[model samples]
Target chain A: MAVATQDTAIRTGRFARALIYLVLLLFVLFYMLPLYVMLVNSVKPLSEITGGGMMALPQVWTLEPWAKAWSTAQIGVQPTGLRPYFWNSISMVVPAVAISTVLGALNGYVLTKWRFRGDTILFGLMLFACFIPFQIVLIPMAAVLGFLGLSGSTAGLVLVHVVYGVGFSTLYFRNYYAVFPTELVRAAQIDGAGFFQIFWRILVPSSGPIAVVCIIWQFTNIWNDFLFGASFASGDGAPMTVALNNLVQSSTGVKEYNVHFAGAILAALPTLLVYIVAGRYFVRGLMAGSVKG
Target chain B: MAANATPDFRTRLQTWLPKLVLSPSLAMVLVFVYGFIGFTVYVSFTNSRILPFVGPDGQPTHDLIGFTNYAKLFSLSHWEISLTNMAIFAGLYIVICTLIGLILAILLDQKIRGEGFLRPLYLYPMALSFIVTGTAWKWFLDPGIGLENIMQTWGWESFSFDWIKNRDFAIYTIVLAAVWQTSGFVMAMFLAGLRGIDNEILKAAQMDGASNWNLYRRIIIPQLRPAFLSAFVILAHLAIKTFDLVIAMTGGGPGRATELPATFMYSYTFSRNQMGIGASSAVIMLMTIAAIMIPYLYAELREKK
Candidate 1:
């Protein structure tokens, strides 16, 4: 009787474990469902997509949709495709990301290594800035941009992003440097090294990991930003997101679902590539931002 | 000897250098962040409309109209619909994300196989922007060419899944898409919290013959309060700032069925040319975000103190 009861307990435990696995797999399917739909639909031609079915893989796959999405898709009266806007995003994001990360690093160095009075309060204020809904600042920001003669300019968008992105990058680097070793700075000080000198030689050499985290975070945020892009930039200055939205929204001719899907994927590819390559740092950045806050 | 000597000019520069390097960021925050907020609040109370009226002297001007914009915002049916939709979206997003995330975290905590693959799979959506998520879901949810059409083709003959088009069900589609993008992030948080829990405590509970359910319910779950709170605050802010998703997916759509406050604010301020009303609505969003953020910030910062 004892043996039989133990046997049943083991079997039940196996069954329960199997149930957990099944549920997890189900969720994985559900999460991947939309992506799968996107991939399959993007490859199939418009004929197969409309005449056949949504889920069926194309009997003959084609990259035409991607080509169209990249070069021929129209938005409003402009048919310049997403290529120019893609470059616009690139130009806008690169400067913004580089500037923001540099500022964040410098800010982090000061906030952590050289503690001053009211620093924490100042940090608290910056963190508060990070979460304020951008809506509150939109109208005034437009006014400021116009006042500065930068309305609808890419350079203006870059300035806006860098300003807002500083809070996050600072938060990231500060948290990182808070736990960083301070003995290096002291030793450098003993060697008669100044602030920027010590930072360039000692701190920056070891900032590889955190810098990776900062750059990736800043890149993703600035690249994927639609609110600022939509509000601040337009016409020749519109980023890929705004252009993509206009493309999807404007349907003067036959609705090209294939091109739409391809465009969506193209827009997503940059951040996706970052996540794939350096996901560990990405998660680290996220946890630091979320958990610490 | 050097320490005892009078401080040199270079040393004094060192003392002030950090402040100088930090001043630019601080000043930017002051002018762009707080100053803009002040300006917005001022705009919210004015009679500014499509454009700020210019006075006879040629400078732009507006009469101080106390709470008139706010009153107009509250009375508008579109604003009311946006608020109602936000309430629904936020409520559902928080509750559903918490539950699903908790479950996924617990399941992953069991030391399952292929966690490496599954964790990233769960997290990849977070890498995509709301525009991508919205468009992807729009394709998958479109009645003619999406899941319903595919389902009908699969010989079910009656597999109806047209929530994206239905007015009563459209808001839920936003919930579904938002949850898909963020639940993985919530799961990651809970998973971290789970990992932080003391394993010896669990061992002790097991030694006391506690069931698995009791172990989670009585001990593990309580310890996850911080994670829960963080998730709630983050998700609440995301829900409040949910413009891109709504705009990308439904465009406040099929006649304001899925209108959110962020979308409402944008359309009113820029598109609909109701800048004052939009600014008022924007102020309301700020308050909502502040309601959740201020206390959370206080608690976190205070804990350090």
Candidate 2:
């Protein structure tokens, strides 16, 4: 009886495992379907795509759309080419991300190290700031920027993003610093280190996970930003999304389906490249929350 | 775990100076974040339009019209449609995303294989801006050139999946993409919550001969309330302000079918040059968001306390 029961349990386990794996496999397939379609259609000739099914693999894989997407489709008649826009995005985003992260780190450092008067009240104010959306600020900011001589410029956009980005970044770094032990700071202090020195040397060493979160979050936020890039910064300084918007909206008469997809691929390249290179770190960072220690 | 043992005001002050050094961030938060909204409220009531009609000395643009724009906002036909669509979109997006996230999180917690790869795959959509995702979705949904066309070519000429162009069902497409984009964060949050649960409780449940479903229903779901609330709040917030996806996917087209308040505000403010009308619309939307969010935020604070 014991032998029979053992055999039955083993068989049941195998069966359940098989079923679970099958379900997971299907789920994976479901998740990848759109990406798969994008890739397959991207490679296929325009005629073939318009003539064929999206799910089917490309019979004659061509790099034509990618080439077109990267080069000509990027420039168009608008004269705002991909390279310049790419530069604009990078320039604006790098500073925005860096400034926000630096301030966040400093804020985190101060919040953690300092037991100050009105510190918790300040922290509460920061929390309150996060709940309010930026849409309300759009008109006021535009007017302010225009009045302050920052209208239709990259600097204006940077300020806008920084204003928006600070709330989340501070929360992230503050919560992260909260999880780190005060003993570390105390030890650094016992060794006669000042606040800046301690943060630069001691606190930063263990900030790998949190920094990755900051970089990824900041990168994604600034890169994919449509509203800010559209409103504050446009013309030659327009980011890829602006180009994308123009591209999709510009095609006259019968729509150029291939070109639209191509433009989109160009616009999406930055974040996609980030994921490809630092995907693991990105997920791990987010999953780990803002804390590193 | 470490707390200051002594009440040393000098040491505290010494430590506190670093925080003061970081006050510039607070300045930005104060002026742009809090103050800008105050400015928005002031503008919403006034008769500001296009350039905001500032005085010659650059003194102020507070030409108060006493809610004329607000009155005009309610009399419009699309306002009702926009509100209804926003309510529906918020409801559907939150419910669907939360449900999928919870299920995915639970499934992941079952010790499934290939979790590392699969987890990121689920999350990749979140990293890309909605512009990219929306662009991809549009291509996939376009009637003549996308999935439906492809579907028809494959020996089903009569088969139709034409929701993308239909004014009525186009909003659902936005929901689908939004869900795809946000579900991963939900899953991760729930996964964190699940990991926080005591393993002993699960073992005890198993010892008591509880079924898998029973264990999840009674033991797991109860513990995941915090994660659920977090997911729900985030989704609800995103839903009310969903602009990029609608703009990229459908452009609030097919006669304003996919129009939410954000898109509506963008069109009126930027495209049509009616800053007063747009600002008024946005102000109302802000109030609505605040109405939902303040209670939720208070409840969350209470729970945290």
RMSD of each: 4.7, 6.0
Report the alpha-carbon TM-score of model 2 versus the true structure: 0.90
Give the TM-score of each candidate: 0.95, 0.90
Q: RMSD, model 1, all Cα superposed?
A: 4.7
Tens digit of per-residue lDDT, candidate 1, span A151-239: 98899999999989899999988887888889989998999999999999988998898899889988988888999999989887899
Q: Which tens-of-lDDT digit does each residue in A1-293 have in candidate 2?
A: 00010111111266776776776667677667666766667787777767755667777888787666656563545544366676788888989999888888888778767657677667656656665655788888888998889887778878878877776677677767877889988998899887778888988888877787778877877889898788777677788787677667665654555666666766777888888888865665454331121
- lDDT for predicted candidate 1 compared with the true structure: 0.87
Listed models, DockQ each:
0.47, 0.38
- Which candidate's DockQ is highest? 1
How many residue pairs clash in all the candidates, one count each? Answer: 0, 0
For model 1 chain B, where is the 10-residue window of minimal lDDT? B47-56
Instruction: Compose the digit string of candidate 2's lDDT tens values, residues B1-305.
Output: 13454546546766566866778988888888778878777777877667746778876655788879889988888877888888888888898888887887676666666776677777787777787778778878888777778778877788787788998899899988888888877777777677777777777777888877788899879988877777776777778778888988888977989888998888888888878888888788778778766666556444533
**Model 1 agreement with the true structure over B177-268: per-residue lDDT tens digits:** 99999999999999888877877777788788888888889998999999999999999999999989998889988788999999999999
Interface RMSD of each: 6.8, 7.0
